[model samples]
Target: MKSKKIPERLESKRLLLRKLNHTDAPGLYANIRDKEISRWLSGVPYPYPKDLALKFVLTAIAKFENKKRFTFGITIKGIKKEAVGVISLEKVDYKNKNAMLGYWIGKKYWGKGYMTEAVKEVLSFGFETIGLHRIYANVYSENPASERILRKFGFIFEGVEREKFFKEGEWQDYLTYGLLKKEYSKAM
Candidate 1:
């Protein structure tokens, strides 16, 4: 399948996924600055600085433009001004037709089904629109919510990389999940 260009916006029943921009820095910082949200994210700093958030937004934009990655800011449909979370298909390998999925939501938004909904739409965009053969995600072994979301989308447990990441001053186990286009199509 030939890949299609990612749309400027993707809509779900209650949320909108759009490209990250400079204006999202404040909201992004506010949401991710929480230790609860940042702890599981190996790449994010614990005390996420405001400037780092701005730099992230700018970097996301650059990466999107370069086709290196596609990052989306998640906002409620009626409240699009602020992003409550972020999702991305990073480490894209066009030749291999695969990418790694990563995402996080604010502490306040936990258990609201927002991340699940966003993941569904993004998976569709990845496999159907982007013609990706496989989309995979890594979850901290201790984080069941993330593992559940991936499993809900038909992501099969691949394996565990023991102490693969060192975050918050300790080593963390990483669980890998993967969904092939065939599996995703069957689930849908």
Candidate 2:
């Protein structure tokens, strides 16, 4: 894991997030293959493959070309700066001053408060740099851990959409939560 001759994109206590690159496909494949990691994830497929990782990286490049939003690979602050997770802003409605936040941590990194810290940093980036008024997150009802993380970040629970998501061969509910710029500022 060589340091990129470039500066780190965003830093948390334990994470030094940076832009996704083609070289990350191997690490993505290795860490993202477990079913547990993909269970609540909307886009990541079960039995994730290396080729799909390459495709995903290409999509990230395309997103950059179109300037949709930013997706970061979360790496720890050390010599081996391999990505331990991902965090992203999507559906950026600049006119409405809002965006959607999403993330997932590798199996080994779960329950260690990594996602919470990453989400906080990304939210700061959203309000301060992206200048967004609102940022929201959607988590499957079965995935209470994500809802807890959002709550810890001061995201208000909006409501649950019944049978709104169809995945893993079954329909499931989704918990929609949101945090406004005021709420974020108050938290800080």
Best by lDDT: 1
Off by over 4 Å in 1: 1-3
Error of 2 at 170 (Å): 2.2
Per-prediction TM-score to the true structure, in the order listed:
0.96, 0.91
How many residue pairs clash in each candidate at the backbone level?
Answer: 0, 0
Query: In model 2, which regions exceed 4 Å deviation?
Result: 1-8
* lDDT tens per residue, model 1, 120-186: 9999999988889999999998898999899898999999999998887789999899999999999
Residue range with the least summed lDDT across 10 consecutive positions in model 1: 1-10
Clash tally for model 2: 0
Per-residue CA lDDT of model 2 for 99-121, tens digit only, reads 89988878887888888889988
After TM-score superposition, the amount by which residue 158's alpha carbon in candidate 1 deviates from its true location, in angstroms, is 0.6
| Clash list (residue pairs), candidate 2 | none
Give the Cα error of residue 118 in candidate 1, in Å: 0.2
